[model samples]
Target chain A: MDWTKEPEESKVYPATHHFRVIGDETFDAQTLHEICKEYDLRAPVEAGNASSGGKYRSYQVSVHFPDRATHHRFHNAVKAAKGVKVVL
Target chain B: MRIAIGCALAMLALAGCVTAHIDYPLNDVKPQGRPGVAVSLELKDERYSDKHSVATFAHKTGTYNQGVEFSRNLRDYAEVFGGAGTAESWYIAPDRLYWKPSGPMEDLRDRLAEHLKRAGVLKDAFRAGMRDPAGDGGVQNPETRGVQNRGSGATLRVALKRFVALKARRPGVDTFGFFGVSAVARSREIVAVKAEWTLLDPAGRTLDNGIVEFVEDGDGSCWRAKNKPFVLNNRAARRLGDELVKALRP
Candidate 1:
């Protein structure tokens, strides 16, 4: 879920937030890293589980998000990457 | 992405040619008479009805009428199809360079439907199709055949009897050969469109039934995108639309 809908007090500025991303094989660690680096979030985006069909890969990351703006931008960027089906 | 673009262009194409109506029953018999003043319309495109004609799409690539007989590229069937013969070295499918409408007549049909609507003619449209969750559109299929009308107006069903096109090979391109020695002399395009419309009263008896026909023979430069033929193709559809308006409203 995006922070835009969440209560501001719950965000606790300068916090570490976890993001779960699902996409095709192209949305691997390196591909996600490009955006994390640009947004200045924690690096080494980790590859996680494969969907039941194995057609898609899941990625997990818990990084420092300075504010909702950065988190939103990072989410949008990930969503736009090649083969990326979703970003949460 | 291509579907999105086609939808966008479909919106634009419909904005123009704001005049017409469309077809049903895959009619071979002549239409008897005109339907009453249409307050609303339902449109159907029957391009997929004829097995001999194949609609073109970017991702699907253009395949000859018979699938097993030809490769997706120019090399395989060029040898046999009387349309165009290509040199053995030509490897790319011409579709790689030119884009064709998945169904041009369908696009034209939408344009006509839009015109009818603006004239205070119809209610909402039954879009072509959609994905799983709430799939509701006039997608041609066995189940779709049974889709009932909104019970407010007449129905228009359009069918393509025949369409064929041949474009001249590009300049400095000797790898592709045409059936004729001169590419310009060989370029050809044809379109045949038929629409049968039916209006039924609330009691389910036929109010009116009619047919509109549009046909053309022309030529294009090498690709579906390039020249004359595509323009001629659009013009031919307009001519057909004009006839429907005349027959339906006169």
Candidate 2:
């Protein structure tokens, strides 16, 4: 199927979305928390398991957006964070 | 000795003939400032004819790699317009939710989000609803509820059509196993790539598209062999990015 041409399915507005972030050992969770707070993300950031190698950590962040614009704004901001390697 | 000289000369001549071309059709619609439009970008790999197997060596070339490069460039470029945005920047292994811990992929979404927040494109919200079990406990605006709005601006989907890498070779003088005394030349590798790109909106409507082709002859020197393909493919990817930007406008 040509996904590029398909219309997006309807999504609930002002809904809570979860973003998972993975970073290397050098990553500081506190800094990320501060940044999330700055964006008005109220949910407590949840930390996940560290890789067996102890080289990386994953964090689950939940935030609510009133509209698509706000969601994107928050998304872009988190994507630009230092030491952040991936956002799922 | 004479044959080796001739082969070297031929390779030099081939290197001199390499060129790049970009073909983009201009769109009448000028890019207007959509400060409110939240742009979400997706990159899909369409290079494989069958979903089950890998692309053949001939079909693999640098197209997927270049597609990746183009996506990064597009995301960085799109940031200037400023709005809510998301991108599929990490490579998910087949049947895997995330890359194995040792793999090199980084979480670009969080990184980009942090950057945008710092830039002040995203506003800070009041920490009023932190423990909503339904995931719907945030501030809501009555005016926006029940509206069929996708985002403020538009969602862009880039489907990669073709990424082909080709090599041209010519026979050269050969020296036997005993090398130091006699000079023998081997076939020289000349590499080239062609990439096709298409841009679409959320509804699958075509926005803009283009094709870019580039060729690079291996410099006749063997010392640079290791880096030649990397350098050449990067050039091709950059060319593709340039054309995409032109087609996208904003």
TM-scores for candidates 1 onward, in order: 0.23, 0.26
For model 2, how does the per-residue alpha-carbon lDDT over B1-250 read when each residue is reduced to its tens digit?
3224223322321111111111110010102211111112211112111001000011111133332332233333222212112223222221111110110111123333344344332221110111222222111212113322111110011101111100000012110000000000111333222233332222223333333222233234323433211122222233333333343333
| Model 2, C-alpha of B133: deviation from truth (Å) | 37
Q: In model 2, what lDDT does residue B186 have?
A: 11
> Relative to the true structure, how large is the alpha-carbon lDDT of every model?
0.30, 0.29
Candidate with maximal TM-score: 2
DockQ leader: 2
lDDT tens per residue, model 1, B1-250: 4224322322322211111111111111112211111111111112222101111111011122211111232221111121121132122331121111121121222222233234221221111111212121112223223322211001121112110000111122111110100001111343333343433222223334344433333334323533211122333333433444444441
DockQ, every prediction: 0.01, 0.01
Query: What lDDT tens digits, residue by residue, belong to model 1 across residues A1-88?
Result: 2211322433235555445555665655677877777665553576655533465665666567676566557767777888775443
Docking class of 2: incorrect
Residue B150, model 2: lDDT of: 18
Tell me the spans in candidate 1 whose CA falls farther than 4 Å from its real position. Answer: A1-11, A40-43, B1-250
DockQ, prediction 1? 0.01
